[model samples]
Target chain A: MNLPRKEWAAALCALPASEVKHLANVLSGELEVRDVALPHAGLGLLNLRDGAFEESYFIGEIPVARAEVIVRSAGGMEERGGALIVDDRAQFARSIAILDAVMAGKLPGSVPAMTLVQRGMEVRQQKQIERKKLLTATRVDFSLLGQEDDEDEE
Target chain B: MSYVAIKGGKAAIDGAASASEYLRSKGSLDEPLTLAMIEEQLRLLTSRVVSEGGLYHPRLAALALKQFQGDTLEAAFALRAYRSTKPRLLESPVQDTANMRCIRRISSAFKEVPGGQYLGATYDYALRLLQLDLANEDPAAFKAVAKSFLRDTPETELPDNFPKVIDSLRAEGLLPPVAPSRAAAFDITRDPLVFPVPRSAALATMARAETGGLLAMAYSNMRGYGDVHPTVAELRVGYLPVMLPHPVTGELMEAGEVLVTECEVVAMYEGTNGDELPTFTLGYGACFGHNEVKAISMAILDRALQKGMQDGPTNPSEDPEFVLLHVDGVDSMGFASHYKMPHYVTFQSDMDRLRTTQQKMQQKESEATT
Candidate 1:
């Protein structure tokens, strides 16, 4: 689903972009939202950490772009019974953590395999970004295609 | 970027169930509760749950204890509340009275007739103090006692499934066809009772009626009002193989067995709808488990209500809906406990109405004085 960057960030935390859109629509009808923003962090684009407990989050000015936008939520009282929009990027990031934990033999069950697939997809996207940059810069969208994603470097 | 929402609504319900389970099992890891244990230890409570829940499985009631955390009343509430969500697995159609597997059968009639009277387990109207020894005794001991009684009277004739007393009346043309015709084929479990129920539904209602309430109501009628003295025409208690129609085979198949207490009472009936002199009419009772009191009370009420109809409202027992509906255990308990829930919304509405009425009354009083 299509989503703005701020929404994409929140979705990365928990919900998918499509679900976030639905929540936004529902909330807009119920209560007015003042503002939304995506803050910077030590990593590339500061994204919400993935966890079942974390849902409700905030995001501010940014327009929609490329990416499979899924809804996610910030972990908070507001997100207690709510949903948010997310994307494959955020899902993959979370899956990596799950996979890392599983490979370390800390996590249990099929959670590792599932997240490994997610991390692999994200790595493939990183490779495509490097090849794209070699070709042309004008065609690259930093947020969507992650033209020079910080995570790709590390 | 705009913040968007996410998550599944059903996850909340799962979380709730998990939380409930955790709360129930906290701390207690030993002496886990069992169905037989509940039936034996908490017999009265189990009986109440079964009576109200409209299901007679003691084990299910015990399982409900785990779900509701050993709160007998709440367990009963849960049992009934969950009943609506369950699909009826099988339908045990009405069996002919002559087909019942009679374990303990008896008749108070003369020495014998078609089937000789059998004293299955009669304290014989003697109210003896309940022996405390039997409370925690091994079940095998009780079985041995019954075995010994049977061995002592090897030649004693035991009555099988005696034909229904009502059938005999029907054959003699004493009772109107309206009597037994209504109950010919009935399934009470599947059907919610409609008001002014046919005799079939009425019988089913009494069959499953709670013992204490039923006995009280029946006794009230007997003491002064309805005057229904019914002789035990027949009584039976035994395990019957519960059969159901197979969807694939399209044939009857035995599911399992359930113990049942069945009793029928014959009372003198004055002719109705222009008939001859007074003849006998039947009051029948049957229920899950070996609850003879419930069965007998049910039989008494069955006869009283039918007989009292001739006398109108003067006979309180004649009101089928009143007796049948109110005497239900679960319905009674749920309704009684429901009052505890906050009704602030409805209460506020009533308070508003009362204020307006008071204002109106004050205005009228001043106007009259002026």
Candidate 2:
């Protein structure tokens, strides 16, 4: 699904915890965001469904940290950015808010912000590929011994 | 009967808290119990907390362990409580276990699979005797002995993906064809579980269930209380990638990897044909971390719950309500611990009823004597 610019920014903010933290650190030097709201921790429910794909059930709760910020572009146009982080990293959420604002405002340096997100995704994909390779080595291959037996009765 | 609330125990409660803290820190001031030690040495416990908490962060689980002073249930509770504070951003795409990076994989049904079975880091063959030498052993000596066990040369690497055991049976029509799940995945945390719970909800509940509770129910089934004889089809310990849909392109993107234990057990079932032939049905269990027993028990329970569909429920384990309601550590612990709370009003009422009955019985006895 093609996401709007703000949603895309939120997705970037929602990158894997370590990657998001790193991206935030890198972007903090490039952009300045005014606090629209203070970052805080909250809770969210995780839902589950049965094997039959029938009804939903409540599993448990998950901690979420969120932050909101406003950014002003070089042209003096301001836009709000918000982040809903999955864990309890307040600083990381704040950084996400800044990046979100930067992207939402369509700031001059937003291209670099998008590039950082792409790089983060690439790194994650590379790691996954390597992990899959190691796991694939463990797959059990079975050797068939006899000629195929076909039974037909009408 | 009357009851009054007790007040003004704040000082005593404060003192008790202080005493507990002092006791926890009394042993040593120099060398502290580190989170690293708990995460590494007590890995199974940490894994249990993570699995039960339904969160994958080992560091947070370790901290919870420290805070709870190594009470697994309480640690899990703390983790769950912490999890509730976090927000839900996006649901990860379904993980394919076939693509997992497996560190260990085994099957009891097959003597050999395409890739040889890897018995990695298991205690199955080790003697149960405790090493008394470890009580005051030097760290350097322990490291030396551990290093001695490592192989100088690496063995030939195994293949990446193995064919699922169930797939072979399905190919030959020995197993029933399973329709793909059509319902959207549900979060057990978000909704209360109702009767006839979906397999996903049951598995989710069991995944975080207390190990002993699950084991007891599973043991009952194995001991003939229920009808299931399970053979380990596949038991694997691995890391599966968590993927999310890309916001811009909508392509699935790898988010991260979570360590998990996945198990599939094959159980005997009556064939659909008119003849008295037998076929195989599958029971699956998976959870965070490398807990084989929990996973296996979960698999057993998963199959047992299915017995209700084929045969009328004859056993307690086969009842979804009985099994699911009693398995959660948090719920059980809360109920169990609540007994310690004051029951003044209820107890006073019971005492009054007993006294009245005793007075009536005594008066009748005196009249009979007169």
Candidate 3:
């Protein structure tokens, strides 16, 4: 069985909903989308390793959106697409899954879909870079804490 | 504990529900708090709900707070209800604190640590005076102040991660060696907690414990009820990345991150075996969102519980069952509020017993006097 992919869908999710919707609209015209099952928008259980014991256990639940689609082109080519995100929009997941199928199958409107995916990737990358810069700025250099050898005693 | 079911309160209950909605809107003074406002502006409060609720969805936590009019316990209960309806997807890959993208890191054990102490966003030293100007804060001024700070701060590329303070101590053989355990992971949501639960279960319980409830128990230990006086090894507040396996390919994929606070406390050391070198006992605490007090208190209690479990419990904090069963916000709140429910039969029976005893006492006194 062919697999439904997620990386592209994740990148697409980073873009604004309107942008994803626009691309999805352009490609969806030539596609017949069928839900492998109904999209799921609910909790995803978060587990963590206990620091002391180092054993894993349930910590909390995070909001999640998951969707799977079988897109059949007008010419009868089929491709499977799926996405699971730690967000709470089933509709967005469905739209991105459709886009994922378009990009993967290289179906009609694939170029525009690829462009949108690139934009989303760039957005995610920029956000990460900015976060890293701010976090690094706060790093401490404790060597500056001690008095210099030539300093006068108080 | 029997309950006499009361009928005919549906209409009154409906009226009360509608009245609550009206009061909530009125209490806002017509300036509704948006979910983003609640999530960002009311961060600590929202964080408390997220921690106590044991759910990492900040937006839903904000929504819960909005619906409950900022009642933390009810908001947590609402989160619990919301999560209970959802299916359990899968367990996440183990997250190591060494990889945590830290925003704040501090150590009380030593003045110098591997990662220089970064006191990122803390009010520990702030005087608890109320800011009168905040009563009518100007939004433009607020934005300007934040903008100016951001603009002025220079950015530098530094190491992506920091070393754990505990690692330095561990290398010196001062800290207890962590023996990797092969125990199966426990899900508190699914299974009934039997007595003498695993250390992981206890940790999970404390992770979602009510801050006040955990504090009350931990505070007693701090005031000399327990022998585990601890030094803070490390306390970190940061975002830990979440990774899940791809549904199809079975390869791990990053699934965003969750904000968390983690703490490790070192307690007094005792020899494990004859002629063996004594090492410091360690306790660990972590929870969703930023609650330093909760994390520290949990760390202390964690050490105490370890001592109790190992050498027999000398304090209530050391007792696993006592602490775990009582510290949950939802459980304690529910049990506390259950008194408001109609307990006519139980109270009436108590009254009957009391009246009978009083009548018997009167007869006995009269006979004796005669």
Candidate 4:
């Protein structure tokens, strides 16, 4: 409740797909959501412009999923939240909307929602570190160039 | 000449399909080709598919590659076909390439750029010799070597953004001032291309064009067919962020990042706008992947087309209609292969005309002999 509902929604939306799915499963029993707007999938255009901003162009379209839901808290308070996710996962979009509504209502389960997001962030960071290590190992070493040059000269 | 029309042969067509599928699966049944391997190992191929298909989904591109059995053109075609099925949503905000998280940046015009040139994952200096040991090498050993290489390389910190070379040129008044485009981007997929099409539409067409076709046209220009001798002012391979305006707050939010290859070509163009001073004009090319040759060729073609606009187009590359129409692999492929279809009636008509001409010539020869 202390944190802005928008920030909470952003955090929830930012979580990895697996983490979001896990969180949804964890919180599905605790919250009740009525569909304000049914989840739908559509395409969003990626507009590109020239260097001088001379003209805008549609490069291509990307799949977008959107949903809106109204959450009814145990305390008899209701809040509506809208979600616009940038993929074709209609279920994920629906879950995100529910999470947003729950955050907006400041329900008792909001504490778990925040903690789940934090956990997801930590996991993502750890994965990023591992990936960096792997990529660093593959870096081409230019230092052994002198040795190769000497061999070529002989 | 005799010709007969036959009914449908659905069973034969079905058998042919089964045979092709069987051939694809026969050899690789023991160890199947995984999508991850295709994505990682054949990265350049996958990138080309993504770029030419005008789609950014790696998984879909990988699936396309699998379905097409590593045929790059076919994979690109498949991806494009898949793209046609999807719906258009909203236009993303203009992405600033100057702020791209650059992995590789180089300039051929200048010996050095503001941030030093970093040649990341390039084959420019690599020896072209085939590695014979790869044929019999253990897969686990290969993985181990790759892992060790990644572990040993020292990490160097790079700046978050790199300065554009053209911007510096503009500051020094070396480049010509660009007029703002009258319209927003033209969607090549939806709108029919009118001749003397906007530069944006032409560029969009080239972005998804067959790399080989673009290269041949550009190569001809570089070899003295057209009037564009360009220096690579900047070639950058990096991730460009895709930002979308938030539905709720109406502020730009980072949706994702797409790996793109961008090239800025510096060329001398005689000004047609009554300006006596010849100014350095820029030709720009950017595509969905790290295809350097495609980007460079596209940039040269972009410049070559500009010359045609000022003076009447003298070369094929300079003609927008000629260049754009032939570059699409799908269109070219479909038309080229259409000859495989049954043309029995036309063939018989041609044969009858040839026989009539031969009989008349024989009759004339007999009369002369008599």
Candidate 5:
């Protein structure tokens, strides 16, 4: 399942210590996971899976946007970061965990704060889908292709 | 939502991620190392990173390795997924073999090429044993063995276009007439393969197919399946140029180079026409990265699948479904490894079926006894 960076990070960081330890164990089997500290960056880890790993960043006990996952291979390192977007329903289910945990008091932070963030992210995703629909709906305008100019002249 | 509610899925998933991280850390690395070290020190492995991962950047491969602490396959997967997102910078033109910068060149046809016979580095005549002497840093011994091989070599000018042996047969009317023009070849990368893929697509599918999967299928074919006798006509491994049209000038320009290995095989087949003459067809294979065995196997499989062949060959290569579907690393790796995820639901279903089957069998046995 493909999860957005923000949701993946939030899900990872907002876990209670028990859940964190659980994830740590699962990740450890196939990867050499490492934690790193940046001056302003929140807690994150270097996840080494399948002989390669990506750097994940988090903020304020919340997973933030713009977390770069760098993939290394034969030619070299490729850093990929983009909007916290998701395509698959399975991914959406996977991402809802941390927010759910926060809501259930299994994780830290004020309930309102976590709820607000969750709602905001969902709104952002909804807006993007609407924008896509709008663009697609209007994409067939002949004027945009410059054919309308000839019709007007005629 | 369905009647079945997924309880504690969030908690379970979160736990899984942490456990994964912990396991990866504990499993792989006992020492701390940076990406720079892997890139600089382990160049061979780094090359593997590119080829397997399908990413051409060594620096990135190194970083990924450092992050993963030498988990090569993981690094490769990460790279491959990332590679899909990157925009293509340019389209490379098909390179001609004549123009290849000969870092190493050899021919079975004559002793030497036009430039002169340079044995280059080849293991063909060698004893196939790993040289422990090379570990002792003996450059002199390396030169001595090379000189001995070239001693009786006939010096000759290399043909501008090396005549392929198959083409020679075509000229003599021994084989089917050479096409007036080279037919456009089908490639798997450009199109999804339907079953009964053409020779070109079949080769492409095999070329990048996972090594282990191909090896297994080839082994199956050799054990028994269909008629296949493979003789390697030629095998060449070297760098090939990546050229592209210059956006401004529109002239083809050299962009870079990638290493490749090509293997050609000849297999006997019944004539396509009504002549009833014994004939042979060609199997061709080429792949990114320097793996000749994979190429050779691919070539053998390619020729085996041609029409008008005897049915004794039982190899997996002779079966189009077996050969075409099982070679790609992506599908095989994903499907094979996905079994690691939770299968409780499937397992429960299996249990229910098993109990029912056993009850029915017992009832049949009791009825028979009565």
Candidate 6:
């Protein structure tokens, strides 16, 4: 639960490399950071259950990047923050982990990281709204088939 | 017969690849094809590559599409080849399709369902007439087009939840309940697929099988080779969120989402066990990206194969071995293309047999004449 969920983690991961790198660049100068786990991009086989037998099988591997880092604050407080996103960049993973650590420990730049999250979430929500609008526009009205009554059923 | 290995023209072979690339690139000098364009313009083609490629990386799929000069089979081959280099990190927790954020959903069997039938972004009803304007399309025009559509679109909330059509059938006791397997489902990548595969393994193979190949097998049954005439219960296309256990917390959380197409089909039920009552049998199909035809074909074939397994196959489509063995495009392409390889040794051996047989026949004829 401490880690960012799918919604915002996607945005964090999708941040332009220059922007994420800029933030991580600044943070590295301030905080004593060390990789608890080396940042690396890898593959994860997505397991899916069948509609027939509920039997699970590997559908395919999604490109992913994950990193874990221990952030040390000036007060000698330490927090381990992890970042995992659906991306294929190791550098992005490390940068996002730094952002995650800052936000988790509420470090100096926590406000800025939170700012990015809000901005990205809004962008995502706007796209979703537009998509939902299109969905509303295209919903099937089956009244032509003498099912005028059923349109109101749902 | 053993192939005679011949070596030479290494430079020419490499030059041939470059020449092919030049031919593909020649027409477009000022404007070059981008990965985004390939992914967007060739949506279905890219989806096929992702599905058949057995990988979910769209950027890489686009690259493969571009690199292979839009040869889907080669693109898929490139992806599978790329996957061999990366380390397998983790196996995701099982995902439920019921949680899909569907962009398009329809049920052929029912007129209405829990969620209203959404007819989103399909060319099914559109005319096949050429739109010549696309040849000189302005990329920036999307802003105007999207804005105009948005202005007309009435605001309505997208229902996050969509109940499965099969769920209602099972509740009504019209369909058999699916019990979870006691053992782990088969992983085809790690294990060799032997005959008499489990349902999971069969589904996995069909999921990644080539679109044309799977269609051909399914079409055989539809054209009266087999008896499994199915009505699609539901077909959905959407972004299915993948859940992975948090590495640190060990709690399940959504990792990411991938575009997928899923189909559930209902077929004629027959009494199999003496004690059990007949219920409508189910066939399920799903794949990495939005290939509706592939999904439906896979579903039909799944039902057919299950029928073949349960009661014994009467036709090729019903036979699991026949369907699975022949539906892979890469495998078929490789085997078929290998015919162009040096077959001189075999041809010579055949020629020698024919000459000897002809000489014997000639001597017998000469003796008879004399």
The top-ranked prediction according to DockQ is: 6
Per-candidate TM equals 0.53, 0.77, 0.91, 0.87, 0.53, 0.94
DockQ agreement of candidate 3 with the native complex: 0.44
Task: Compose the digit string of candidate 4's lDDT tens values, residues B264-348.
Answer: 8998755656755667877877787779999899899988887776576899888888888888877787677667767788898
True contacts kept of 5: 0.00
Give the C-alpha miss distance for residue A108 in model 3, angstroms. 4.3
Model 4 scores a C-alpha lDDT of 0.73
Highest-scoring model, TM-score: 6
- Tell me the tens digit of each residue's lDDT in model 5 across B1-370: 1123457689888997888668657756557666766765576567555555544556677877766667766676776666555433222233454444333333343332233333334455689788776678666876676465444343333322232344444455555443322333443434787865555455545655666666666665556654556655555554544343322224443333445555566656555557556666556655555555666666666666553133533555677776778776667677777776677777788899999999999999999999
* Per-model i-RMS: 35.5, 6.3, 2.5, 3.9, 25.0, 1.7
Task: Give the per-residue Cα lDDT of candidate 1 at B50.
Answer: 56
Weakest ten-residue segment in model 3 chain B by summed lDDT = B246-255
On the 0 to 100 scale, the lDDT of residue B10 in model 4 is 76
C-alpha local distance difference test of each model: 0.49, 0.69, 0.80, 0.73, 0.46, 0.83
Ranking by DockQ: 6, 3, 4, 2, 5, 1
Give the true-contact fraction for every prediction, in order. Answer: 0.00, 0.12, 0.47, 0.36, 0.00, 0.67
Assess the local accuracy of residue B321 in candidate 4 as a C-alpha lDDT between 0 and 100.
86
* Least well predicted 10-residue stretch by lDDT in candidate 5 chain A: A51-60
> Model 5, stretches more than 4 Å misplaced?
A1-154, B1-76, B88-91, B105-119, B122-191, B220-227, B269-279, B308-315, B356-370
What are the runs in model 2 whose C-alpha is more than 4 Å off? A1-27, A30-154, B1-4, B141-161, B273-278
* TM-score of model number 4: 0.87
DockQ for all candidate structures vs. native: 0.01, 0.14, 0.44, 0.34, 0.01, 0.62
Write model 1 residue lDDT over B1-370, tens digit each, in one string: 1222334646976998999877767887756677777777676567555554555556777777656776656765676565555433223343333555554566564224344334444466567988888779887886696456444543422333455544554567665444224223334555687776665566656655556778888888778767677777667665554433322223443323345666777776666565455666667666666667777787778777765554554566767877878776556766787786556677778899999999999999999999
Which residue segments of model 4 deviate by more than 4 Å?
A: A1-16, A52-54, A77-80, A100-108, A115-154, B1-6, B145-150, B154-156, B269-277, B364-370
Q: Please state the error at residue B189 of candidate 3 in Å.
A: 0.4
